[model samples]
Each structure stands twice: as C-alpha cells, then as structure tokens.
Target: GLSSCFHRSEGFMRGYPRVRGFYEVLSSCFHRSESPEGLEVYLHALQLLTTIHHGIQTLAVAGGTGQALWTFLCEVVCEDLCQPDDPPFVLQEQKGLLVHALAVLSVLYACQNQEAEHSEADTLLPLVGSMLRVLQYHREVSSGHGQKEKKEEEEEEKVDEQLQALIQTTVEFLSDIITHLTKDAVCELVTRGYLTEKTCLSAVGSLLPQFSPAVQHLVFMLSEADPQLADTVRKEFPVSLSPS
Candidate 1:
C-alpha cells in the first residue's frame, strides 16, 4: 500500500512541512501493523526523508517532533526490529529493513546528539549494542558455515547487494561511534552492564580483521576505561588485535 502511495506522490517530500508528517506516519504504522514488510516501507520512506537538507533540518525539530522521533527510532532499532531470541538467519531475511533503519538512524542519531548531549548515554549503549548484534549475525550468515573466501570478489559474491550495504553501513557507523569513545563514556557503558565480555566477544567476531584498526582502537580505549574488560576481549583473540 505505502509502496504504491509513495510512487504516486512524486513530489510529496519537497517542502519541510510535507516531510514532518512522515515520522508521525511511521510511528503510527509500526504500532498498528507490527509487520516486518510493513515496517520496511515506513523505514524506507523515513530514510528518504533524511536525504535532503530541508528534510533533515525539519527532522531536527526541537522538543516538539524531532525529540520524539529520535526516541521512537531508538526503540525501533534496539527492540522492535530484531530480537535476542531470533536466530542469525533473521538478518538475511530482513536485510532491506535493517539497511533502511540503520542508515536513517545514523542520520537521526547524529542530529539528536548535536541537538542535545544529555541523552547520549541513554541511547548510545543500546544503539551500539544492536548495531554490533546485527553485525555479528551478518558475519555468521555471510561466512556460509566455514566457507570463507580469501579474494574480496569471491567473498562479495556470497552476499547480495542489500546485505553488502548493510554490513558496510554497520561497520562504518560502529567505527564512527567506537573510535570516538571517551574514557568516561566507556566507563558508563561498563557500569550500566552494557559493555561486558559477551558484548566484547561479539564486537571481536564482527570486527576482527575486517575492522582491525577500529577493534584495536577500542581495545586501547577499554584498557584505559576498564582493564578487566579489555583483557577479556584481548584474550579472546590475542593475535588478531594489537594496541594502536
């Protein structure tokens, strides 16, 4: 329904006023439908809204709309999209929605972070946790059960285009967040029970040789923020990561 609606309204997202309703519509649809395919349409449309300067500016609405949107999207990503009980194969099944949600959230998270720094801790841990979880699943499915390939092109052939984009976006966003962690921020994540050995292991599994530099940097940060956590991560893969 929305796919057709979006196609019919060719220039609906031109002005700021026209784009403001998109978030409200997305929130309403997700609550009503709760279907993966339906949510995909909403996230895709929402992603498009963030592509323009005018739309992004409108999305940066202060206490009125943008704040609500930022909060809603965090829940959408961390809780609604993929659940802990779901298996790794779900990542492949929901590639399109994952790509759309993550891409748009990255944009909105940046906007919200700039708008108000207070909620960073509130949202950052769960948001990064979800991104890492998705990435770990991507790695699990993409590996094709011990069918690893050395050549980049050969590896590329195993995953479809949408999934390739999902993996790339996940790594990029995770890197942006991980590489900039303050010692205090890392401490907060640890104290709040978000940064633990299991989380570190997932981080290692996804990052490893693909994101060696980032993993290495994260290790350095952890060493300063909390040595026990850093040691746990380091022991998991001693050879793969060296201090930066």
Candidate 2:
C-alpha cells in the first residue's frame, strides 16, 4: 500500500491528511512487551517510506517526527524484538519485524549524518546492543545450520530469505555505526552496559574480515579507555584484534 504512494507522487504521505499520526496509531497498539499479530505489516509499510528521498527527508527531520519515530523504534528494537535474553534461534521467529525495524532505523541514522546531528545515547546505544544481539544470534543460528546438506540448504532458501534480509539489515546498519564510531561512542556503549567481554567475542564472530578494521578500531579505543575489557576482547579474537 505505501509502496504504491512512492511511485505515484512526492510528498504523498506528508500531504495525505488521513495518514497523520499514523505511526502513533500503530505504535500505540503494539506494546513493547508484545508483538500483536499484524505488527510486521505496519512496520514493513513504515520501512517502505524510507525508500524514497522525500520519504527519508520526512521521517529524518530531527526535532519533529524523526525524533519521535527514532524513540519509538528504539524501544521496539531494544525492548520488543531480538532482546539479549532471547536465543539466537529466535531470529527466525522475528526476522520479518526485525528487518523492517532495522531498515527504517538505518536510513534515519544515515540522514542524521548529513545533518551532522548526533543521536542520543538513549536512542543509539541500546539499539547498538540490540543490533549486536541480532548479529550474534544470527551467527549462532547460522552455525547451527552448518550441518545442513546442500539439498537441505537449497530447500530452505524460501524460508531463509527473510532471515537473510535480517542479517543484511543488521550488518549494514552496524557497518554504518562502526564507520562513524568514536571514543565517546565506545565509552557510551561501555558505560551503558551494552558492550561487555562476552558480547565482544560473540558480536565479532560473524563480521570477521569485512568488519575487521572498524571492529579493531573499536577495541583499540576500548583499550585506551577500558583496558581490561579490551584485553578480554583481544584474548577472544586475537586475529581480529590486530592494530588498525
């Protein structure tokens, strides 16, 4: 439904009076502790809005709906889906919603970069924790599937598409965050209890090679600040811990 608007005209969503408070209406019904039956449909529609320039501009307008949307999404990701306490296999259960939520957040975050606006720790760090949790769990589930034969893997492709989307979404967003990481950002992750020694090992498992440099830089910053935590990470990932 929303995709139809994208091809039709610019500002269609913004100009549509009936669409006002659309997010609030949907969000109010989906509580943080619950995922009602059709939540993914709504989240997917919201995600469609991030696909076009005017749509991205509309949602990323900081100090307005962008800020509100960010807050609501952070809660959904950090609180509602793929929680640290959830098992990695849970990724299969939540992939559809996770992909949509992450896609929207990633676009909005990129928009903030153009404006040179920094996302608050509340909005960003917890989401980082959740995103890392997503990857770690995805890795766990993927490895769990390592025993699948070629035929089985091929047979599962239809079922695996949404899971693949979730992985791609989480990785892209994490890559963006890593690309723009800073000392203060690392500190916030630590201070907020988002990044710990166990998380350091697990989160880096799937992102090897491609994400090595940025992840190493992150650990190096950790060393400069929280040496003990850095030491734990270095011990766990000696290969990825090379000086960057």
Q: Which candidate is the best by lDDT?
A: 2
Using all chains and alpha carbons, the TM-scores for the candidates as numbered come to 0.74, 0.80
Score each candidate by Cα lDDT.
0.71, 0.72
The sequence of per-residue lDDT tens digits that candidate 2 reaches over residues 45-159 is 7787777676677776666676667778888888877677776666766777788888988887888653344456767778888887877676666667423334467657865
**CA displacement after TM-score superposition, residue 60 of candidate 2 (Å):** 2.3
Taking the tens digit of each residue's C-alpha lDDT, what string does model 1 give over 1-244? Answer: 5445444443654523455476777777788754667777778877776776656777776665667676777788778666666677777666787788788867866776552642476776777777777776776666574233344786456656777788788877787677667778778777866677766677676666777777887888788888887888878876333455
Candidate 2: deviation at residue 15, Å? 4.7
Q: What TM-score does structure 2 among the candidates reach?
A: 0.80
What is the lDDT for 239 in model 2? 48
Give candidates' CA RMSD values in order: 5.6, 3.9
